[model samples]
Target: MAVQALKDYKFSPADAQEKFHGAQLLYVGWDEHLMFCAPFAYCLPPNTLFSDLCQKFMAHSFGYHPDWKSVDFSKVTWLKSGQPWQPDMSKTLAELGLKHKDVLRFQTPGLKGINGTCS
Candidate 1:
């Protein structure tokens, strides 16, 4: 299965961004070279490979065991800390009309706080 996926995956940055046409994105943070595209429209992460996001998404989405070291995540756009997240988010969420209850769900991120973030 692993070999098959790797062989068939046409991992392209442009293809990914296009797949999520008009998706309302929430900037979680940066990973490797990719941004975490968590959309407010659904509790699940948007189908974007903004970093190594696609690998984890594949693991979660397919119920596969994520042996990160074995995965060749050389396709992400990595960034560093203390750097601005490009399109700025301070004025971003304020534009949405969503309520607190609307975004609440089991898979909602940050619920685990720092514990879930620590490597």
Candidate 2:
């Protein structure tokens, strides 16, 4: 049922595997007194099917309080993407230099050496 609702959702991704392949629940809203669904579901996307299961679990889990009127589901956010991991300049350059001793010109072959190095 919840899965169907997710599919019907506008922002929800179609074909969970493709769009939400690496989708992860960054943080599940926690209910202090344990009012609803434990308010927590931090889990790694093991597989595509697991992703769907997770979505199903998150969509509708009002546990003890199953009130459609009193419940506030305004904070259920699917944090699929995370902070961009910036490459360490020093490490990256060092690795690159070590990996490829010959740094080919990014441009075309004819312009290999536009300077005096060209034969």
Candidate 3:
């Protein structure tokens, strides 16, 4: 799926300052059956990469997994509002319209495969 394009809104450093100070928080969890580890709270920074957050979540909560290396980043999905959340890893949290206490679910790359197909 394609990532959402930026809207016609204008952004300035002053606007960024307000958002930075009032940054939101998020809850991230693995999909069902991979729920052994507890979900963690994240301070949603304006410029945090989704992939970086995923790596941090896996390492901190579940320790090392052999299958991580073979996983495809593009196939990873973050869901909110029944849609993929920010499919582009390079996009920042602010760009994706993420909000306070937003709950997100991630489907691991290799676990579900793209469109449920075995890769």
Candidate 4:
């Protein structure tokens, strides 16, 4: 469906990349983990390494979960902006082609939330 505007509605997006000082907005979600309810957003530099993202940021964000420690990054599947993506852990976000407002989702093959209830 197309948006029906009463007038020429045009303005800069409030969450545009320029709004963030040297950082880009990125969203990350853990598949089947309803415990988080939704993806977490972060304002980070494009040069942030993928390894740091998993070991630092992600660890800080989802470490409290019972399944967190069991998750193996090597076995985890990834999706970038809703499409399958194979990322190099040593590469930076920019090197992986991630851009502002990109959504990254990961699934731990055997670890679905507690009891597989998705939470």
Candidate 5:
């Protein structure tokens, strides 16, 4: 349901890209992993390489999960903003067409949380 404003509302969004200096806002999530509860938000430079993002940022964010060790990037299914995506690990986020506030979700095949409970 769309929200209808009872009165004229005009204001800038606090989370706009410009508010983060040169960094862009990115959201990443692991599918069927409820341990995280929600996606992780990151403020990073657009020039950050996809490989670095996964090896560094994602590792730090989701590394504690039991399934993290089993995740194989080659076999994982990736989705960008809810659509299927095949990212070039060698390319930077900007080269991959990822913009501020974009969401990247990855689902590891044969892995669905600990004991397949989606926890």
Candidate 6:
């Protein structure tokens, strides 16, 4: 039963692995205290926009309910290699010097901006 449940899990990455082969796999996380949440691994396309990635994180990590739409994109900030990730001012992942398994920290609205370390 447990194995079957794992197979049916909503966030399964089996398909994504096949589809995004050779794509950079980035670890995205919402900065949280007490380690209450888990970071998401994304198979980011080479030309994916920063804004689009932010939206995708919100939708997938937080769920796509009607209430999620009210969240402001302006307050969304990402940190890569300890530097701020600007959506409007940045280019693609490859252009931004991001490699596979790079961890990007996300600072969301209403959450105190605290950097969390991934082991």
Q: Could you say which candidate leads in TM-score?
A: 4
Off by over 4 Å in 6: 1-20, 33-36, 64-70, 112-119
Candidate 5 Cα lDDT to native = 0.93
**Tens digit of lDDT per residue, candidate 3, span 43-102?**
657577766666665556544444455555577667885577655666666666676667
Q: Give the TM-score ranking, best first.
A: 4, 5, 6, 3, 2, 1
Cα error of candidate 3 at position 113, Å: 14
lDDT of each: 0.32, 0.32, 0.60, 0.93, 0.93, 0.62
Clash tally for model 1: 7
lDDT (Cα, 0-100) at 35 in candidate 3: 35
Worst 10 residues of 1 by lDDT: 99-108
What C-alpha lDDT does candidate 6 achieve relative to the native structure?
A: 0.62
Work out the TM-score per prediction.
0.19, 0.23, 0.56, 0.92, 0.90, 0.57
> When superposed on Cα atoms, how far off is each prediction in RMSD?
15.7, 26.7, 11.5, 1.6, 2.2, 10.3
- Give the alpha carbon lDDT tens digit for every residue of 76-112 in model 1: 2222233322222232233333222222111222222
lDDT for predicted candidate 4 compared with the true structure: 0.93
lDDT tens digits, residues 1-119, model 4?
A: 65689998778889889889989988999999989989999889999999999999999999999999999998999998788999999999999888999999999988979898989
lDDT of 5 at 11: 82
Model 1 lDDT, full chain set: 0.32
Better of 2 and 5 by lDDT: 5
Per-residue lDDT of 1-119 in model 2, one digit per residue for the tens? 45466355556554443354454333344222233333454333433242333345544542333332232333222222232222222332223221111111111122212132431
Error of 4 at 26 (Å): 0.7
Clashing pairs for predicted structure model 4, backbone only: none
* Of candidates 5 and 1, the better by lDDT: 5
